[model samples]
Target: MRLEEIARRLGLEAAVAGKGMAAEVTGGYCSDLLSDVMANAKEGYVWVTIQTHQNVVAVAGLTSVAGVVIAGGHRPDEETIARAGHEGVTILLTPMSGFEVAGRVHALLSQTS
Candidate 1:
């Protein structure tokens, strides 16, 4: 699945146009803790979390995540958006909870698999 497709399926709002939209979504990971994501999130995964801090962008770039879906209507701060754009990371916002986003992502990946 592609990042765009996943974003569409989850009704996400893209923060940066076309950024990481073409990246392949190999899987998804949901976690609010940066350390847990850094330790376990697989490359090419779309991360679902409520974290909107600037450092999340750095972690996404380092982990090579396909994109980030900020759940529960959370939007990244100005610095976070700038960092994400600079790092070529996709940031998506969703009104749904993290669990809801995770379930949708899991279903989408499972269908493609």
Candidate 2:
């Protein structure tokens, strides 16, 4: 499923839609620790985290993630959102926990795949 489709299905709020990021999501990964996410998340995967910090944007860039999903009803700081925008990484916000978002995204991708 496409990122936009997944966002709609999960009721995720789009915080930043940088360049072609919305067209890049092929999978999903859920992790709260920045280091674990940076190390384990695959490129083109929607990264689900609750950090909501500027470093999350940097890590998203490093991992080449399709998007960053701020879970648990958290909003990223202004700097984080701006950086994500500049880096062409879509930023998403959701009221669900990281695990819930991950599960929903995974289910969607599985069904579509």
Structure candidate 1, residue pairs in collision: none
* 10 residues in a row with least lDDT, candidate 2: 17-26
Backbone clashes in each candidate structure, one number apiece? 0, 0
lDDT against the true structure, each candidate: 0.87, 0.83
Q: What are the root-mean-square deviations of the candidates from the true structure over C-alphas?
A: 1.2, 1.4
Over 1-113, each residue of candidate 2 has an lDDT whose tens digit, in order, gives: 67887888888898997653456477878887988987899888998888988999888889888788899999899999888878777898999988888888888888877
lDDT per residue for candidate 1 within 15-99, as digits (tens), equals 9643568988898888999999999888899899999999899889889888888999987899999988887888999899999
Model 2 misplacement above 4 A: none
Clash pairs, candidate 2, are none
**lDDT measured at residue 21 in model 1 versus the true structure, 0 to 100:** 85
Scored by lDDT, the top model is 1
The 10-residue segment with the lowest total lDDT in model 1: 16-25
Find the candidate with the highest TM-score and give its number: 1
